[model samples]
Target chain A: MNDTNSVVSIKDVKKAFGKNVVLDGINLEVSRGQVVVICGRSGSGKSTLLRCIDQLESIDSGEIRAAGHLMGFKEFNTKLVPLKDAAIAKQQRDIGMVFQNFNLFPHVSVLENIMLAPMKILKRKKSEVENEALALLERVGLPDKKNAYPRQLSGGQQQRIAIARALAMKPKLMLFDEPTSALDPEMISEVLDVMIDLSKAGMTMIVVTHEMGFARAAADRVILMHDAKIVEDAAPRDFFEKPRSEHTRLFLSKILQH
Target chain B: MSWSWPYFFDYMNNGLMLRGVWVTIWLSIISMTIGLGLGIFAALMKMYGNPAVRFISEFYIWLFRGTPILIQLVIIYTGLPQLGIRFNVIESCILGLALNEGAYLAEIIRSGIMSVDKGQEDASRAVGMNWRERMWLVILPQATRTIIPPLGNQFNGMLKTTSLCSVISMQELMRSAQMIAQIEFRVLEAYCIAALWYLLLVSIWGLIQTRIEAHYEKPFGSQEAVSNSEK
Candidate 1:
């Protein structure tokens, strides 16, 4: 999994809650500007793996490196110890994440949501951050929604604002955890369009989604997870046309039926 | 059996009674403001501090809330002087009221902060905000929506509770009423005037509370419409 150009490296990552295993011995490498889509059944570890990469969920054993630094641990006396909150926060600045729910701050206008992290955490100049935030809003095709509250917008529009908010940090990598899973069926395409544009602009991304169309259209590699392990990993063409694993075949059948 | 309308009117217009009402208003305003600050501090300590810090806050809240405010006032104004510790009348009244008010408000504030969605926390953390930034900028603003209604109710109670300080000879509204009653033998009229003042003060606060609540509600949009659209 070691690669000089890799933006993210996961080796033998294992995570569990109580008695239930969520991610088991996962190994992956995401190179710079690579668009990776991981698809699986509901209980598969795809989402958890994405969360682990962002240090939102801690791994029980093994290592995860992102943006040229350890994810959640700092080397102390040649032994790995968990970093403090401040250090962890510094690491998180480089890796942006979007949840299934938009999770925008309901109390603020959309523009403030985009401006807050850069201004407060990074201590950037207000005028500079405000300009970048407006640009990001324009990038997400919501330039007109600067003053709108999150609750006032439709779910799809809110998700776009969430994407703009994440982009305001100018992160090295982005992780999307079911970005469109909560939207109405008709609203899914608008959010996906923004993601596809992001992928085209050469931002490193790892997406967890059930949208096979998106996987085939924009992904460099498609991965199938089953029973807490990655069962299949292949280029999009081979993954859809000629999957190697029996689990991939059955999973594909179930999802592709409709 | 003998209630005099003329005496009631005279007491209501009395300069002493008017000053007493002013004192009561000042006491409520100052104590409630200080109590709110203490409540926020204590609640944060109980929620996020280490075990020792948590125990200190827990004990403060328990001691203040469990005891009667009147006894606490008496102890501060009268009893403490026997041990070479003394506070004047005004200071003791305010200290007792604020400590008691803080204990109750701590619980109210804690519950309000807890009611905020866990997702809000996750989002704030994802943005690389430190604990202080997250609490102050993100969590507290949202928690305030839930905190306001109960906070208003607490202030309303505080307006009336200042009467207890009269026992400590603080010369607030109730004390003035009692003095007038004793001197003029117009107990009914004097007390009635005080009651009317209390009713008037509480009514004004109720209106202001409604306005503040409405202002906070604006960012979240109407509750009914949000729920319907979300569904």
Candidate 2:
């Protein structure tokens, strides 16, 4: 990817917790409006990398730049000052994250859940936010369940509401951390359909998922991570067909077998 | 030897017994309010505060829980006098009752807070709520449902515990009963009156508890009943 067109840039990112090293010297770049899929076996730090981008997980060392703003490190007194929790939250509002668990507020209705961030963080007028929230809910095909609590919705519908809640913030980039991994097998396709439509709309997204079909169909580029490093990064067709790394070939072989 | 209804009214007519009931209600309300406030703070400190704060909270719980409430009352009301901290009988009784009750209330509040799902915290954080905001808006609201039943139990226990204050000449229910028995030499009548008053107060509190529990119960449905019934 050309350096100038990149919206997210990570360089030499290293993170460790006590004796366990999670991400070791990782580097990646994503251009504006591109869907990049990250796939790896469990414990390969795929989720940690996405978390680091949102500053949810602090990095031990490195730099990350998103939409021209430096993230993951705070500068103070000629040295980097660790960003406070509130400051990190302010930055995170610009990039919404969707979790595998669908993490909806159980007590609030679907409408309230979607409107909460916009009302609380953006201080948007409730009527205008409700209008926008209704539109997003309609888009997700859950207009009928607007007043229903999360427990009342199916896993597929809950995940769709989660997607709409993220979209309510109008984030420049969206991160999905195994969004479909926790769904029931039958519910997976509904969420994937929503994501496929989102990608077609040119929404910039970084997705950490094991769904090969989603990678093959929707991802503009696919990145394969192993042992805390990216072993292969290429267009989906080439990465699957002509994987240069032995690790990539083995990974593709194993995943394709299933 | 038979039950004497006229003697019960006679005991009620005694100014000392009537005053004792007033004093008993006053002590219960004040001590319970203080206990509930301290309980909430201790619970928050134990659950969400830093190591030092949590350590202090744990130490407070340990110190009070390790000792008997009667012993605590004696220490506060009697022992402190030797150190020149000469609080009046009412102040001493309320302080002793509040401090002892606060420890038990803290445990109740902490358990209530813990019962909330961790996912709720993550959901709140995902929406960019800070720790204080998350605790105040999300965790505490849900915790209220968990806390009410135990809080009702605590208030009932506090009503009984107020009897301990009579040891320090506080002239509350039991103390007034002792005075009336001494004057009229009607030991059975005065003591019976005090017992009846205690029962009546506790039963009334039980009614209020039922109402408060029901109010908080609406959002939670039967989940709380299943958990609390087991407890």
Candidate 3:
């Protein structure tokens, strides 16, 4: 279904790395302000789907549309031609992504890291971008750590600053690729709390995470992927209590065991 | 023939030795500038260019790095003249030193670029940075920290390597020493003065390299924050 209001629409998208099939005929949709949580076994394409949506990983076949724009390509005479890197980058202006590693530039400070994209890519005015960056650092609860470098800050703080960096672009949709996977156990909740605040305030997010508490608290729908296909998609309450697919049931048992 | 401090001071204070110092400094500076230009292009070609371009760049690095620079200097200066493709003594020296320096710098640069976490490139793309923007603004900025110390070593090495140009009779520091030695017959004193000059120049560069490394590391908050990459 090509819904007019959908922020992201993936149609039978398939991706492979050489001979290994990564995403096999994945079909999904996310509406504006929807929080979709995806969890699965490591090779089940949970993170690949997020990368595909971001166009960092090219799909072998099928199409992904983000914010009504066809991703990574231009449509000419019913033929799909891959767009130039600049064109693809322009199309990605509305998408913000936070990687698992935080990836804060070590050469710049935290405030500069948050200010860089809006000032460079979007060409926003420097003073305005600086104000917004400061406000975002405050929002993420690290206003005083503006001058600190990524190596100086703890993992949780770095991830929070990464989120602030992404939001400085004022993107329409945000993608989180297991944002907390690299953090210490005690630090996970700090990053999750920022994400939960974003969810409560109506941000469109697609998160690949194993945090079931986050899923139950902030997710609109929970999806389970098995062998590169999304095998189960249901409301959190329904999926947690009455999972339909045996794969998801087994998956939840394994995760919840801890 | 006896050791004399007055004779040594006289040799060191001459205008001829001053000109020799100028020639050595200018030769090294120009060669380094050319080497840096060639090195950046060669590194990018090898890492990101198509197969054909990559092969060409690889062969260029291989040809230069595989041979002694003195032999290359002789070939360019003496051998090419016989083939009717003549370069002046100065041009020949620059061509030889720059090509050899570029090859080593290329490998140093490529490794520095490779050492960056792949996630940095992904993060740049996620923020809508194009390939060139990411390379210049993001990747190179981070790669430079890893690239600098080795680059400093390369620069100091390049300074000393200019001595080889004397074999081509380009009249740099060593050539001047030879000329002064043969004429004045103060062989020991003239060569000793040249040795002292070389040592002083290298020591000055070492101090400057340390300052540059400290400046680049300032953003990281501590020297340990940006760990030293292998030389």
Question: Highest DockQ among the candidates is held by which one?
Answer: 3
DockQ of 3: 0.54
**Model 1 residue A64 lDDT score:** 96
Ranking by lDDT: 1, 3, 2
Model 2: CAPRI class: acceptable
For model 1, residues B139-222, the per-residue Cα lDDT tens digits are 999999999999999999999999999998989999999999998799999999999999999999999999999778877876
Better of 1 and 3 by DockQ: 3
Q: Extract clashing residue pairs from model 2.
A: A74-A81
Error of 3 at B74 (Å): 3.3
Off by over 4 Å in 1: A1-4, B223-231
Candidates in descending DockQ order? 3, 1, 2
Deviation from native of the Cα of residue A182 in model 1, angstroms: 0.5
Let me know the TM-score candidate 2 reaches against the reference structure: 0.86
What does candidate 1's lDDT look like per residue over A150-222, in tens digits?
9888899999999998888888999999999999999999999999999999999999999998998899999
| Global lDDT scores for all candidate models | 0.92, 0.85, 0.91
For candidate 1 chain B, the 10 contiguous residues with the lowest summed lDDT are B222-231
- Chain A: TM-score in each candidate? 0.98, 0.96, 0.98
Give the per-residue Cα lDDT of candidate 3 at B69: 96
